[model samples]
Target: MTDQLPLERLALWVEKRPDAVWLSQPVNGQWHDFTWAQVDEQARRMASALQALGCAPGERVALLAKNCAEWFIADLAIMLAGLVSVPLYPLQSAESIDYVLRHSQCKAIFVGKLDEPDKLAPGIPAEVMRIAMPYPTMAAQYTWAELLAAHQPLHEVHRQSAEQLLSILYTSGTTGQPKGVMLSAGAFAYAGSQSVREMQITEQDQYFSYLPLSHAAERFLVEMNALYSGGRVAFVESLETFASDLRHVRPTVFFSVPRLWTRFQQGVLEKLPQAKLSRLLRIPLIGKLVARKIRKGLGLDRARILVSGAAAIPRALLEWYQSIGITICEGYGMTEHLAYGCFNRPGQVRFGTVGKPMPGNELRIADNGEILLRCPSLMLGYYLDPEKTAETITDGWLHTGDKGEVDAEGYLKITGRVKDIFKTSKGKYIAPAPIEGEIAKNLWVEQVCLMGSNLDQPLALIELSPAAREQSQEQVTADLAQTLQQLNAKLEAHERLSHFVVVREAWTVDNGCMTPTMKIRRNVLEARFADQLGELDARQPLHWQ
Candidate 1:
């Protein structure tokens, strides 16, 4: 905890190593690197520019952008001006964008790189001030170039105190309205400094960031980590150039959600079939060569630490990555605690458990099986919602709402969500996560959700993998039915799946069936398919929707 607070750390870097590059961004086949001195100068200028535009200290300022050098600069500028930052998701629907801006009552917003600038333009209130970044964006009254030209760097900067409120991060809602999680400077300092030491992160490390900075994981694990550890960060330009950009960065520490990890596996398997890959790995000399080539191809050759979070990854998937000499460490945490919790340590990798809690976190299981955590990095509270905040944190303990089991050696295995367990009409309770995890191991399945509320038996709604969709329907169905039968043998009578409703529609963030972080919205899917699921009969076990 002795590491300097965020602002102080930035100041230290600016003074100690002004010439060192801190951020780089790829754009249109060119790389833009920003040194510490440059970042400090721009941030200082923007801070003055904000005050000149009638923004007062302590007012909320929003940032709407994808990951870029300017994104980091704008965040630091917000802090420099003594303003609170509210980051909006780059690809969020206009409705969500509108809701957040209104809910936060933002005084001004800094616009930067985005996917659909025009589509999200209407979300900002016309009266609110708009400050555009260097990149093209929706029309704004103030531009980065104009601001830098008009104002000199502010001589005085806001020195942050540990307890001061830093930002309000709205949780990417899986079911209900998104609540703003209030995090203080101390939270970031605690988590960032702790993680830097625990992971042994140093200035020599490199970070590749693509996930939404609006989400807590990316903000904490990537952005804050870079600032605290004095590491260099590179951002992807576009979806089309993700592979090339990732290859170019060849990051030292990589963080990704389970969805992307799944896609990476699919991409590798598509090029080299599993059978052929397995055969190549059997040879002593060729195995090492083949594994190294695969790592380089995936742009993870230099990544000493590969992390997966935001959802539970299947054990079989982890095993597959292990076979390729890549150990994907799956961790567990939530936005309420700034995403600081249990994690599988590097080199001491565990298979089925998210490793023990970090040094300062306290973990305990409630009588009802819910996991409770208490830590210094826990959020101050939800913004303007005392009742909800009170309910979430009681006696200094945060109710995680997730059920888990910890082994004697302190490893924790998430069993299921306390709210996700449902009882069938036959009075048997089912936890869908373990069942869904087992179902997801099948090659034909891409995503699976088990829903059965007051029904005779739980039914599975499955999204087919690309390879499965290319196969004949009959063959796919026959293979899936056999797989279902084998899976049911291991479950209790009531827990056995009654139907396999193969769905063609993919559940994605844009479709409202997934959170921005890519965790499936179970409640949304359950309600969406309620009628279709009810129409099932005992006549057949499988059907296509």
Candidate 2:
């Protein structure tokens, strides 16, 4: 096996199996397939067009789009032309987008489907060239078809060295300004191979792409893995059609975050009550048949490898899925490491651990309880921020800000974040994540953020799940209060929660309370609820907003 760039792999697939399906997209309630040969031709044409427009090699080009076939084509085109691809999350604010464009000095951008084109148009400077994707855009200089038709197909392949910069992926910036992560071609090639080996991926595997491709986890797991293994990729049309799309694709490999995994469990429980399903599964011969039917209905019957990452999943949730015959292998990684640190193996399952480090990757717990890592796939550094980069990576070890512990069997379990631990007014430090995770075990809670920056004790701001929204407010409050009481009993004196405040407004990407990858923005949430906190007494144990 050669350690070639993704474009080289694409070229190999084009020569070996030109007619094989490379990408699939839904349009007008139907799926359309794009063959490897077609992808190659379009990417080359786009590359040629970029050169015609005076795009120099090593210049930055931005991509702003939702998940689609055109996004992948544009990325390959950028790499083919020897330019760096800078991907912007579709849900990013116009101000943040403008900041990134200015910071990266992007010369051009490929625009695709956006929620509000007019609102985002001002972010891109008029001097920069704009090439519209296969979507409607009023601010583009040329469309996809026009560009492809106007330029010749580029036949000369620009072979990039392993150390060549591949892309600059900006973080979601939960606390501060987003940092541009500089990843090289060699980093991706190494991480991709490791992922394929760990998951046992093959050419026959199918992947359903619904997560934002801008995140490192999705980019590495879905896009890069498919390129390495010559697998087929299917894109979901929209949120409403996710279930139907999953059923249609019946993917062999599935990866999801903690929130979506909980939603899936809630969906199945809604169809068949959890108590009845458990009773049915206890039967002698009918158990296996019933379990298969349930898995099929949830579009997971054909899934060979199920994985979860991006956040700590509740142990109860994993146990529930295991009861139904699905074992979710939790993975641990970050953008700095190309999301390739460690993973729970298939058979040697541990209930509450993220598992051992992968082959060739070194992991250790620091004296301060922070998890440190040294891997071949580690990123070069943060783009244009040498001082910050130096602070992050010291002595060949990348300091993962997360606190963790390693067991005797080499399994690693993340405890909480070092930065996330806050001090109360009483001069005691409390780690709110573990407490929040305990409260999150309650089915009614959709999202929770613990706040106690300078207050006497920590406070929980919660948003109820959709199913819980149907219940009366009184019933919801009673249930939440009971859950909070139980959680407080398990906590120490300083770590106990002072009050539970149920917020009426839902936290979502559009509302700026959530990052693109579905992680809660603690600073944003605290800012939004700053004024109301003064109304509640610190002595109160529970209150409903």
TM-score of 1: 0.98
lDDT of each residue in 401-443, candidate 2, tens digit only? 9999999999999998989998999999988778888888888
Among all candidates shown, the one with the greatest lDDT? 1
lDDT of 2 at 18: 99
- Candidate 1 lDDT over residue span 435-503, tens digit each: 999988887888999988888999999998887877899999998999899999999888999989998
> After superposition, which runs of candidate 2 have C-alpha atoms over 4 Å from their true positions?
537-540
What are the clashing pairs of model 2?
Answer: none
Best by TM-score: 1
Error of 1 at 362 (Å): 0.8
